[model samples]
Target: MPTVLVTGASRGLGREFVRQYAAAGWQVIACARNPDTMGDLASDSTVLQKLDLLDPATITALANALVDRPIDILLNNAGTMGSQSFAKHGLNVQRFGQSDYADWEHLFQVNVLGPMRMAEAFVEHVAASKRKVIVTLTSMVGSMATNAAGGLYAYRSSKAAANAIMKSMSIDLAARGIIATPIHPGWAKTEMGGPNAPLNPVDAVAGVRRVIDGLTPEKAGRFWQFDGTEMPW
Candidate 1:
């Protein structure tokens, strides 16, 4: 069976990805901050591993434990919108002065640095697989050309940095035959997207899976939408 390693599998789109991949007969290595909290992922076929993005030891440990295993895909889905202050339900697009510096630091650490570290740790595992792919969950707001509304300073900036990181990784890891790209899952209904989001987690996950399944080396480093459209960087 093809093996996939997914982060942030405790809930939301990550959870949906785990469920779908496992049900389809894929060997899933699901990582969450608290593995015990993910009772829904308790399947005989899925291996739930505890992963704290803020902790490097855990990341290194997971990589070492799976050193001999080939991972077809590594989904860097673990991230935060920022501290739940003014942007809990939806993003708070206030004036530039309303920026939270502390939240910005935290967001960058989680959304940008964490995935880069993940890629570093598991690049070999993905390279050894039959289908070598590394996918990072980015956002449309990360696109500078698409910044029409202007706001979400912390969240937007971090995602943009993440996009840049993945772009660099795509080129650097190409010799290893690994495809790396950033993807936007659309305005899905989740804790971050709020209740009235246009897309649901199931549909968004399905669409993203379709996009991932169709990825080619030529498409590496490009920003993509869940619907398979190429996004502007």
Candidate 2:
């Protein structure tokens, strides 16, 4: 069976990814800030691990523990939209003149730096696998061409940086047969997406899985939506 290492598997899309992949018989290394919070994700094929994207030590430790394993997919799915609750405050907290440098720094740590660190630590595991792939869950708000409203400054910039990192990884790791790309999961009704959002976690994750399933060398380094449409970077 193919092995997939997924970060942020405690809840939301990450949890859904764990469910889907485990159901399909993949060996899942599910990483969360608190492994105990991954409720019911445990199975014979699923290994729950503790991970905190903000801490480099935890990342390195996990990589070392799984050193001998060839991970077919390295799913960098952990991210943040700062401390603001989009469900209650909407985009007001992240709007112009309301920029919080601390929050922005936290967002960059999780959204941008975390994936870069993961890629660096796990590159060998991915390259050794039969179906080598690295996927980062970015957002449409990150797209320069798609930005019209322009309110989520921190979140948007972090994701954009993540896209750039994945692009570089795609180019640098091509010779190793690793396909690196960033994918947008759409406005799903998660805590970050708010209750008003149209897409549900289940369907959104399913779409993302299909996109990952279809990834190829020619398709690496591009921005893709959950529905399989390429987004402008």
Candidate 3:
């Protein structure tokens, strides 16, 4: 069976990815910051491990634990919206010069640095597997060409950085036959995506899986929407 390792598998879109992949008979390596709350997901996977993106030790340990295992797909799915810092205001827009630097740093750590670390650590594992794909969940807000409104300073910039890193990885890992892409999961109705959002986790994940299924080495480094449309920058 093909194996997928998903980070942030405790709740929301990450949890749904675990459920759908495991249900489809994939050998899943489900990871979460805290695995204690992952009841059914733990029982359903080939392995359950603690993988906090903020914690470098955990990243190193998880890499060590899976060193012998070939992972077909490594999903860098964990992220922070940095909404707590902007909670009193909102994420859509912030006052000029009022953005919190700490929140920006935090978002970059999880959304950019963490996934880059994952790719660095797991490149060998993925290259040895059947599919050989690395996917990070990014956003359309990251697109420089599409930034017409331009208000979500921290969230948007972090995702943009993520896209750039994945693009570089696509080129760097090409010879090794590893395909990397940053995917936009749409405005899914998850914790970050509020209840009024159009898509649900199930549908969103299904679309993303289809996109993943269709990826070839030729398609590496592109930003893609969940519905299979190519996104800008």
Which residues of candidate 1, in runs, are more than 4 Å off? Answer: 85-89
Candidate ranking under TM-score, highest first, comes to 2, 1, 3
Q: Any runs in candidate 2 off by more than 4 Å, and if so which?
A: none
Q: Would you list the rank order by lDDT, best first?
A: 2, 1, 3
* Superposed Cα deviation of residue 1, candidate 2 (Å): 0.2
TM-score of each prediction: 0.96, 0.98, 0.95
On TM-score, the stronger of 2 and 3 is: 2
Question: What is the per-residue lDDT of model 1 for residues 1-233, given as tens digits with 9 covering 90 to 100?
Answer: 99999999998899999999999999999999999988778788799998988898999999999997999999998888876533344555534887778878988889998999999999889999999999999999899999988878888888999999999999999999999999999988877787878999999999999999999999999999999999898
Comparing 2 with 3 on lDDT, the higher-scoring candidate is 2
lDDT of 2 by residue, 1-233 (tens): 99999999988889999999999999999999999866688999999999999999999999999888999999999888988777777666688988899999999999999999999999999999999999999999899997878788898899999999999999999999999999999889887788998999999999999999999999999999999999999
Q: List where candidate 3 sits over 4 angstroms from the true fold.
A: 85-91
lDDT (CA) per prediction: 0.90, 0.93, 0.88
- lDDT for each residue of candidate 3 in 1-233, tens digit (9 for 90 to 100): 99999998888889899999999999999889888777667654557889988988898898888887899999999988875533233455544576888878988999999999999988889988989999999998899999888588888889999999999999999999999999999888877787777899999999999999999998999999999999888
